[model samples]
Target: MVKKKKGRSVKKNPNVNLESEELTQAPHSFIIQRGLGHGHIVELTRDFRKLMEPFTAKSLQEHKKNTIKDFVSVAGLLHVTHLCIFSQTEVGMYFKVGRLPKGPTLTFKVQNFSLAKDVVSSLKKQLVVEKAFKRSPLIVLNSFNSDTAHMKLMASMFQNMFPKINLTNVDLNNIRRCVLLNYNPATDLIDFRHYVIKIVPVGVSKGVKKVIQGKIPDLSKCNDISEFFTRAAILSESEMEDDPNSHITVNQKLVSRGNVEQGQSAIKLTELGPRMTLQLMKVEDGLLDGIVLYHHHIHKSEEEKLEIQKKRDSKRKLKEKRKQVQEANKKRKEAEREESKQKSLKGMPKSTVDKDSVEERDDDVQYYREEVGAEPDKDLFLDNNQTKNDVSKVLRKFKKKKNENFCKNKEDKFERNKQKFGVKRTTQFKQNKSRVRNRLVGKTFNKKSNVKRKSK
Candidate 1:
């Protein structure tokens, strides 16, 4: 039996990285539906991620336990510029686009939306390809020329979501997708759609175009080559009727052949959608919070606005005062630490002064050493090795001197008694001399207790 060879694994290319100068400067965002999410909203977030494409965090897997702050905290390090949050409520689905760190957030009520899979399923042919999303989609805005401040801001934000193109040096082949934002003044609603760009030959029939495209269609149903031209329905069902508005003569070559000629090329767009219809509900001055700049549903009186502003000012001032107090305390602690450290270092070299004070009484020993040049008597010095000189060590030295005198006197008396009493009396005197120290200590204790001892 022959062994089958294992197929080689194909590694997917990494997403647009940090080293790319153009991508780093461009606005990047995360489509987040953190915390709890409903079924439609979770799927909606997934579909919207596709619309963001290679520049955005395409592989960001958010947990229900995760929070907005978790993403916000790291957004600056990753150079993320914007945050898109989708949430569903009992009334409707809401979408928020907030600038990172500090933000003027735009909140929209999602009137309706269709997912990408649903859009593709409705079409006769699916044009969703991995190659189409390799580069960011071109953004085209319509009816955004209104003088309203919010409208201008919305237009600017939408434009910045996609990277800027330098048409002079940009490759035509990489321009594969586009996003269209059409605003309607009548409804005050925005229609958002994504599209895949395709350039096809206008003059040629579907059969010849297919041959040029290198896709060989089935010929079993066709009787002859002429039948392909004669039969109107025999061409692919996915083929769309050519629109005159879509046709444009190309000045340069394209990725596809036969569409490069000046008169032959036509640009067609297929809906690559997760289509959205949104109505701006509110606009905030900060990241999802702060002062409300505009609100479609709310109106406040002049007095109320003034009162709110005064309260906010008071709170801000109080916070700043507390911060100053904390800073002052921190500086005080650091100063104290430095002071203690300096005091310790300055006091480190005073050991010589301490030694001189401890041995003040030993001046005689030093004088003899210098003048006599002889070894001093060991008995003259006190044994104070373990600790400083104490009363106990002094008493011990006095007792040794006293005992020496007592021993000499007793020996002389015992020698006199021994000469008169003979050898037995001499042995008894020797034993008494051995116990003389113990007998002296007992006699002192007996005198303190007022007791008499019979001494022989």
Candidate 2:
């Protein structure tokens, strides 16, 4: 009686129920999470993103994109040989996935560390699945703070992540020793990029202690250790020529011991000790790298030695020929200078007969005597008589003309002197009158008296 009966209300359902029984449903598409986290999920559908494939025309074309028209993919099969990271300010990191050695590299830029980490993780997984890690030893070249504790941390992380592969630091020297890759660390950047490791061929020799047996080789028997070394060097050079791959590396201690007086005489064998090692030369990245260690003498064949000697002899002969040619040229030049001097003196008069001219005259006389069977002395005398007569006549004429010119010049000079020094009668009279007037004026005479006296 105190409360009215509560009215029950029905709750409305937001979901509508179909009246018709026939229902059509869309097919469900399944998605597999790559464990790349939420940040990388969108990368799955990127146009440039692709999975590595075996090298084939179809596969290569399929992976190619028009977005980057200038991009050139690696020539060989697409494989992930290395993982590299670059630090950037605007973007957190830039990663590169290298292909085989000398092949093209693919790159991706990430704005955050988390996304970069996921991308790298995903790449490593793919590499493992493809068995790319097993083909070659993986070398981790980090350009990041090498002296800091962070490097150690990064190294540890890489080791833990890539346990199946052998991860090592980037040592250019050591790498050079092993391979012939054309990589220079001093001038090259290694940060934020993966490099395909090109293995080098290198040979390491045994320790010095092992190479030298009981006592050092005796050098007393030889006059000087140099002779022995010369023989050994020749032998090694010949061996190297025979085998292009062969190299020789001699230890300094062995050389010094061979030079010692005690070792020189006692050493009988021509070859090096058994403990030495000979390594073959290997090419890396189109470059020759590494050294061979050896402790023995490898001589060349007699034929090869003879050929070398012949070549040296030929070179000597060529040099001698060149010297002879130069000497002949020098002689020809001297002859030309003499000829030019003679031509220059041909028209000029001389006070005395030149020695060269005398020699030439003698030669001419001898030639006339031999070829014409004539008395050359008599002919020369007659020629001189005629020439002397002509010269005397020319001198007489020149002297007469010179005398006439001298007389004429003397007369002209005498006339000029007489005109300059002798005074004229009229000029003398004017001068006398002016002088008298001046004297009368100085004596205080009147102008009228001076005029009257001058007039009288």
Give the number of the best model, judged by TM-score. Answer: 1
Candidate 2 Cα deviation (angstroms), residue 143: 7.9
Which is the leading candidate under lDDT?
Answer: 1
Residue 228 deviation, candidate 2, in Å?
Answer: 13
lDDT of each: 0.83, 0.36
Query: On residues 296-405, what C-alpha lDDT tens digit does candidate 1 reach at each position?
Result: 99988888888988998899999999999999999999999999999988885667766865576478689878998996887565434424456767788899989999
Off by over 4 Å in 1: 1-18, 61-70, 89-91, 167-169, 233-240, 338-456
Alpha-carbon RMSD of each model: 17.8, 41.4
Q: Report the C-alpha lDDT of model 2 over 1-456, residue by residue, as the tens digit.
A: 598876654444434453222111211111111222334333432211221111112222222232221222332122223322222333233333322334233333442222323444544222222232222223343443455442333333333222132235432212210101122236432222222222111221112212233336445655775554444433333322223233233221232222222221121111110111111111122101111111123445778767866886798899999999999999999999999999888955554545556666778788888998977665463344467897899999999999999999998876776687654754666677887887877854445556443565
Backbone collision count in every prediction?
A: 0, 18
Candidate 2: which stretches are off by over 4 Å? 1-134, 138-230, 235-456
